[model samples]
Target chain A: MMVSLARKTLLHEWRRFLPAMLAVSFATLLQLLQAALVLGIFGGAAVYVSDSNADLWVGYPGTQSVDQGRPIDGDIASLLEMNPQIESVEPFYLLDGDWRGGHGTGGVSVFVSGVSTRPGAMMFARVLTPALRARLAYPESVIVDPADLNKLGVQVGDTASVNGHLVRVVGTARGLRALGGADIVTSLQTARMLDPAPSDSGGPTYLVARLRHPAAASSVVADINGHSGFGRYQAWTAPAFARLSVLFWLFNTGAGAGVLFLAVIVFVVGAIITSQALMAAVAASVNEYATLNALGVGKRSLRWVVLEQAFWVGACGVVLASVLAALLIWLAHSNNVPVAMQPSVAAACLGLVMALVAVSGLMAMRSMQRADPATLLR
Target chain B: MPYSNTVIDPNPMLVAENLTKSFTSGQLSTRVLDDLSVEIGAGALTLISGPSGCGKSTLLSILSGLQAPDHGRVLALSESLQAMDAKRVEAFRLHHTGFVFQGFNLFPALTAREQVQLPLQYMRLSAQEITRRADEALAEMGMAHRQHLRPAALSGGEKQRVAIARALAKAPALLFADEPTSALDAANGQIVIDLLHRIARNHGTTVLCVSHDPRLISHADRVLTMEDGRILDDSDRGAR
Candidate 1:
């Protein structure tokens, strides 16, 4: 009966409560999209290092993120080979260049990652599926993500000029969505050839290190970090590098702070609207609450009723918000917007809305407690 | 002092001793009840009638455990209403007392049946028993036909009847009514008064009502009249 009282009150005042429900729904939508935007940017920042088939990453000492890496001596691969825990090292070459597609697309900024194709030695190249991997082996061949299809306006078998060098489109890959416009994957020689450098200018920008035992990556990283005269190069366990990359975008840049500020604004606005709506509903029924108190209903029971009402309104709002958020996410996805919605992100958003509901319910309960049963005598 | 209405029952259902209550606002204080004592017997319809603000309602509130006195104590069913904490007072009211209000304070969203069943739900009765008691209470109040109607859909008299049913559904040992018929017409008020009489006579429930309506005077077994926060007259004793 205590539980049903809340349900009954909500059902009784649903018309008046609709505003609260809608407020909660709108709040949920804001919370989800805001979280997704931040998570998407974070994901984009770390994708390059995370999708690699390496247990550790070797980069320049000041490289706060993978994208900020500077060129290192390619001979470090031979030195790292001496480690007992070392498995294989793949030198990775990354460059940014303008691309001209044969399919009438204008110049667009694109990033290229060069991967070693030596048998069992291409760690970064493992990101491509087997078919794309085989197709990328051809000379002057490159692979792009499916999202790049519309931007590059070139598909499989099409030709694209990267920095004035014509490269054939071999195949496409997944999870390679780019942060800085578009990305392409090609063999090491082709990638180096496109940007011919001084013959003595060391090696690739970074090294992808596979470990014999993945758990020993920290020890390997420590050993590499301790190596003398390695010249500005830093080694990291893969997870650490990924976290660093995410943190670089999140704190090192103003974009993360801007997104975080907007999310806070959205959360506060939604919470205020929801709390006010609930408070008004409770205020209107305060007389009935006093009568209940006079009838000997416990304070806890009355408190439960208000809380249950808030929960019902919040739950309804979440369901509605989920639908709206899904449609918005789908539209953004189709438009190639980088709003990522992971299951964990959605769960977090839901948890935030529930917290809002609980706070509002408790606030309303404070007002309910002031209801004097003596009012019934009047 | 103890004022008698007929022979005072040796075993009283409720007793008040020098109960005094006052209200203050913005540096002004008015004594609502001034050291007045009263006793209510079991199984009788006791009416406290007086002009507005004469403290009849205040006395009812104190005696029923709805409010505490400023300087006195109330003993009901061998328990101290003044000494109990708020939670215990609420529990005592839930198990031993019931109330019918002048406003017919029905939840607008609940059907008449639901309004009556609200009190019984807290009693830990089986669902069937709750339904049975609710239905019987509504039937006794002549509200059976309109049990499914919400308060908004019910007439003034029907709403009052539903409130009465809500109070009576718990089968309380002591029932307190505050101007229960104030909002109804003469005929409807008479109907409600008849119901109160029936409840006291048939169910052995102590019914204490505070009202200004003189029509209630003839039906009450004992009528206590008040003036300036003091009992001015007891009909059985002919004087205070």
Candidate 2:
């Protein structure tokens, strides 16, 4: 009976309750989009590790993120190659560089990734195909993501200066994007040539290894770390390293804090607007409530009616938000805006929305106190 | 001529003794029901008629347990209303009483049939019995054909009839109506009064109504005329 009454009233007076529903929908959409954007932005920081084919990454100790990699002893590669589980090991050079585009276009900060030009190299194996690797084999030739071409003021066949050394843009790739700066992809030889410091000053920034059996990566990493004979470095499974990078950026950065604050504000504002709208709706029907009271409906029963109404309102709002969020997410993807939504994050957002609705329903119960049967006689 | 202050009945459903009620507005206080006493019988349509502010509505409120009297006590269905707590009073009302108001306070969203079924739903009746009672009450009020229409679609009289059917569906022992016909046209008012009369005589339910309209005098089995919070006359016209 409570369900029937609540539903019929909402359907009959839909215009009156639309504001409350929309308030809930707006809150839900904001939470979902915010979470997606946060994941996408932070997830970008780990693209180098995630988009590679490496089963294990051996980097300098305490390397918090892939972009923050330090030079590790090149001798570490031999140690990895000696392991029975390791099929191949390659040196990966990651260095910060300043790019000066041709014709005085502009100067931009960039992360230079220097990898082997071998067709079967484990480093960036998924992104640098055979053709791109062949192009990078040319002297001082580099690759950049097409999306960052304008940011770096360069186009294919253009020449640029990296750390005061001239380099040619041989091609563009899709996954070579970096956080906080553009990415420049070149061969290990070119990167050594472009370096202002002596080539032998430090070894490669990190060593990446491919395993004969991918599933043995965790045990192999454990064994490598336990043996301490491998120089001053740490080894991690590729997934663990990627997750470490993402978590570092998400929790240890100011931008991440700002996104968290925005989420709090969305919840507060959504609760206020939704509760007020629900209260007004209840107040509008106070007379009908009074009539019911006069007919001997108890206060407990009346409270249940309000709760059922809130539940319906929240259900409808969630449906509306799902549709709208899907469209918006598609639009963001088309525009190359980084937005990622995991199933777990979406479920958590849904639980928050239901909690918001429940809080609003409890607040709206105060209006039932006005349903005094004595007022009806007057 | 000597006027009787109370009606004599063999089967009394409501008895009030020296009921006193007052209202205060800032510094001014007005007495609404001044030490009034009455015995209303079962199976009769009783009307308490008076001008505005004469306390007829207050009397009905006290008799129906909607309000507590300041000075005296009321007994409805042989249970002392003042002796029970608020929850007990509500439970008693839920189980034994029905009400109709001047505004025909049917929920605007509900159809005629839904309105009739609302209180029965509160009673937690079986679905089959709820539907059966609602249908029976609507048919009795001649609202069977229009049972699917909402309050907005129904005419003033039709809305009132729905309100009455809502009350009647509960099969309460006492049905209270306040200004039930004041909002209706002459013909619709006639129809409502006749229905109230029929509900009392046919169902053996006590129908107590408070109204200011003198035209309702002819339809009531008894009329208690009031002015300034005191009953001036009680006349029984005999069963119609």
Candidate 3:
């Protein structure tokens, strides 16, 4: 009987709910886009952190994010390896550099990391392209990110210069998008040759160390920094540094805050539009509700009718919203717009629509309780 | 019809004692019913005839449990109407009291059969039971052929008969008709009055009709005449 009643209400009063459904669908699509932006930011952060397989990062003290890493001297790297608690220490250079690929119409700056060929820290991000490895992989070859394909206008056989060092771009792999802009992977030998004062440049901007045992991080840092000569360096755990870097990217500017504020506005407007539609339906059926009450229908049953109508409106709104959200998300993704279609975002949008329905149901209840049965006779 | 089912204990179907009803219009108060007392017995047709402004409709409303009198009591099957709670009165009215309005209160959207079925919705009857009851009521009112017709398709008099069928669909203990004949012409009014008599005799249902028409007085088993909210004369069939 309740189901039949719902069908009658939805069938008869579609105009009352269509606006609300459309509003919710729009909100859902925007929410998906917002989620995609959030996902891309976080996904990119994970890739950047994992690419560096260093167990411990020893940088300047009080550094919240790796983007804010302060430079330390090469003397600290030298004195740190002398400690008995340290298993191994390798100095690595990290910086952002621009590339002119395919005649450099739109210049794309990429993050460059200098690495040693020996098996040590920061080996996980090593680009493994066989063709490039056999040719100029040692000091003459460089790997560019896939993201720079259009911006840099480079192909597989393009040659690019880095800091006055004429280098050939042999292979195209993953790990794009830099702190300022896409990564241009360069060898430590090539980077040192381009950097002229490489020896005096503080023995790699960061000295990464692997703990002999996982639990010995604090003791190792303590033993190394306790030496009077290495007082300038700061040692941080991997998880801590990764978390700091993500926080820096997320909260560094007001970009995330602006998106959240816009999302809230959309949600509020959607809820209002939905409630107005439901309220209009209730008002139109006011006389019928009174007639039903006069026919000796219980207040609980009348209340149930209002709630069931609300359920129908919400259900229709959610279905329409889901389809529209999917379409919009697909359109954005195909157009190369960053939109993460995560399950949580879908669930949240659904929950929001249902919540609007519940609030409108509550509004309809007042009519049910207050409608005088005698009014129909009048 | 079985006598046992139609006549329950042979008591009066409705009793009113010293009934007084007043209405507050704007700032002033007026007495519509003043200590009115009456009894409508089973298997008999009782008519209350009065001129305009005689409180005929008000008395009917009080009798049908639609309105409460200010300082009097009403009873149905010896059950006091004034003392019972509002919900109980409403339930009793729904269960045992059927009302036919002068305006022919048929839902415009419903067909004749559906109109009759409206009064039976509160009852826990099976689909077959409801349909059978609706058909029987319409047939008794001589509206069997018009079962599928909407109120818009029916004449003014035919609409009143449909209203009667809807009221009788519940087989209520007492049928209250407020100016049932006022909305019909002389010939149609006679047909409605004859149907009331047949139902009273054949079904043993009590009939209490409120009307101002002198033509309706001839068919009544008993007539109570009122003037200016006062009963001026009470007479039987010969004195009618």
Q: lDDT winner among the candidates?
A: 2
Chain A: TM-score in each candidate? 0.87, 0.88, 0.72
Q: Rank the candidates by lDDT, best first.
A: 2, 1, 3
Model 1, B1-240: lDDT tens digits are 222233335688899999888999989999999999988887678899999989998899999898889998999998999789988999999988888889887887789999988878877888888999999999999889999999889999999889988899998989999998889999999999889877876787888999999988887878899998999997753123
Candidate 1 C-alpha error for residue B71, in Å? 2.5
- lDDT by candidate, in order shown: 0.83, 0.87, 0.69
Question: Sorted on TM-score, highest at the top, how do the candidates line up?
Answer: 1, 2, 3
lDDT string for model 3 (A1-378, tens) is: 111444556675566667866776676666666766765565455344556666677877786676555557867766667766667777666665556665646556566666555643353344534443344346667776666666667777777665655777777766444444566666667756655345444466677777678577766666655666555677776666776776566666666687678777877787677667766766666654544444444566667767777777778767776777678778866665545555766687677667767776777677665555443321
Name the weakest run of 10 consecutive residues (lDDT summed) in model 1 chain B: B1-10
Q: Report the TM-score of chain B alone for all candidates.
A: 0.93, 0.95, 0.92
lDDT of 2 by residue, A234-341 (tens): 999999999899889988887778877887787777777777877887788787788777788898888888898899999999899989998998898778888888
Clashes of each: 0, 0, 4
TM-scores for the candidates = 0.88, 0.88, 0.67
Task: Note each model's CA RMSD in angstroms.
Answer: 3.9, 4.0, 7.4
B237 Cα displacement, candidate 1 (Å): 9.4
Per-residue alpha-carbon lDDT of candidate 3 for residues B1-240, written as tens digits (9 for 90 to 100): 212233322477788889887779999988878778877788867789888878877787777776678887888888888788877876786677666667775555567887777557667777788889899999999999999987779998898898888778888778877778877888999999888866776777788888888988778877899876778898766222
